[model samples]
Target: MGSFTLDDVLAVRKRRDSWWTVFLVDPIACRLALLVANHTSITPNGLTRLSMVFGLTSAVCFAQELLIAGAVLFFVSFTVDCMDGKIARLKGTGTPFGLWLDYVGDRLRVLCCAFGIASALYARTGDVIYIVAGAGVVVLDLFRYINGPQLKRVRDTTRAVARENSGAECVFMDELLGASAPGSSTEEVRREFERAGDEDGRELVDLQRGFRAQFPWYDRVRMFLVAHRVRSHLISGIEFHAAVFVVGPLLGAVAWLWTSAVSGALLLAFESVLVYRAWLATREVARAVPVNEREKVLV
Candidate 1:
């Protein structure tokens, strides 16, 4: 076997990776991925497709009440999900189509897992609550997918406008939320804000600061959830399955049901706040920028 190290794995990780991935999942997954990469001729897309198989298999196991089997398969699927990107980076063979396929696979995995769990619980108890919980998960996932990009665009546009007006490079929102890159100096970021003298520039900075103030706790929680492409959606899936596979077996099925339901409701509420805040911040930035600039921002 080819020798690999922790630093080698860390090299492929993104700047704003999720805390769950950074602290728990990646260490093991990355090691496994490196070993597989060194030993085999598999492509990154091959690993991605393999993950989809494990994900669907896990769904089936969950639907059949094979809790331990389902949990094991889910872990395997997630591990491979992490591996595909690492392999892509290692091989330098990543393509846009590969990214698209990975995204589609993720959506499918979530759908299958949620539906399988709901159907399984419904079969056992004949209640509609599980179905509702499952539906809620799907809806929230859709919202997160749709809203996340829009919010990012708004934030990016705001920063661009500020930069144009102030002639200073501003820090990204993720940095303020504590996902700073290595060697990113606080003084440099502070100077960027200090340079914002024009009305549009000042407004942009204020809106960014206000967003941070409004969601201090969310920012903290988001640090751990940040690694996923769709953080909220991924977190929801993790919470649901953790309840089913871990809590269910330990606390009994009844506890799992209630926990999943309550957690889904809470997630929906949290997502609502995020969307609302993003909208408000977008509006503030849009209003501050010139009409032509705003049009460009939207485009």
Candidate 2:
């Protein structure tokens, strides 16, 4: 409707995104989204397609071993990639096709960029290790995308069942934790934390299971990360893409290789932790649900 402010743009962004996006890309994207939403007639799909063009051009730059240009363009491409979603949320002009395109386009761009990086590296030095590392990165990325959502679904289902078993009324993860809120800023998140209560049927901090019960050391870490607007997970797929596409291209080949390697390792390690926690939570849910049923029968 009226002119969109920076806050308006940010309000529609994901509650949690890659630290790379929160820090580097959001500054540009938030501003650009504001400008586009207010002044232009461009749809979210338009931005998606525009991002693809930049991404492919970046890939071409990388293929030619134009490291500096490639790095800059990739950053720009990623920033633009972030804008489409924010604009969609702000303007309410998102389409199913846009979502599908955004998802598939991201993977395609990454694969193209991966090919470009590997091709140039192999051409420059003829090292098989580069190709191997690139392949490993691609595989890791694919695994995260494929398994991460399913794991989240399982974890959420476990938590829901556990809460239902214990006769708890508050929803913890979705509201205040995962949902995109207005401003989606650290301040807004803190306000949500303050607003948590059972009296109003709102989100309450669940100390019953999952990481909260098992990992006491993580409480402060989670608080700190959430306050800083970073993901609670130490290293995720976002960091993995950021390392390979951004940090690597800027720092040189060796840094790129090690960064991508370390990023992938960290992502896997964090994912494994989540899986273990989910397993524990599921077992507890199984045991608790039966006990609750028995109590209900006795009553």
lDDT of each: 0.66, 0.75
lDDT of 1 by residue, 157-267 (tens): 766775575454444455553444334444444555455535345432444445666766655455544433224334444554455444553454566577666666666
Model 2 RMSD in angstroms: 5.0
Clashes of each: 2, 1
Lowest lDDT block of 10, candidate 2: 290-299
Q: List TM-score per model, in order.
A: 0.76, 0.83
Q: Which stretches of candidate 2 lie over 4 Å from their true place?
A: 160-210, 291-299
User: Which lDDT tens digits does candidate 2 get at residues 136-235?
Assistant: 8889889989888887787577556655666543234423544444335534654656565445664443423465556666645655666567777767
Q: Pick by TM-score: which candidate is best?
A: 2
* Model 2 error, position 31 (Å): 0.8
Can you give the lDDT of residue 73 in candidate 2? 85
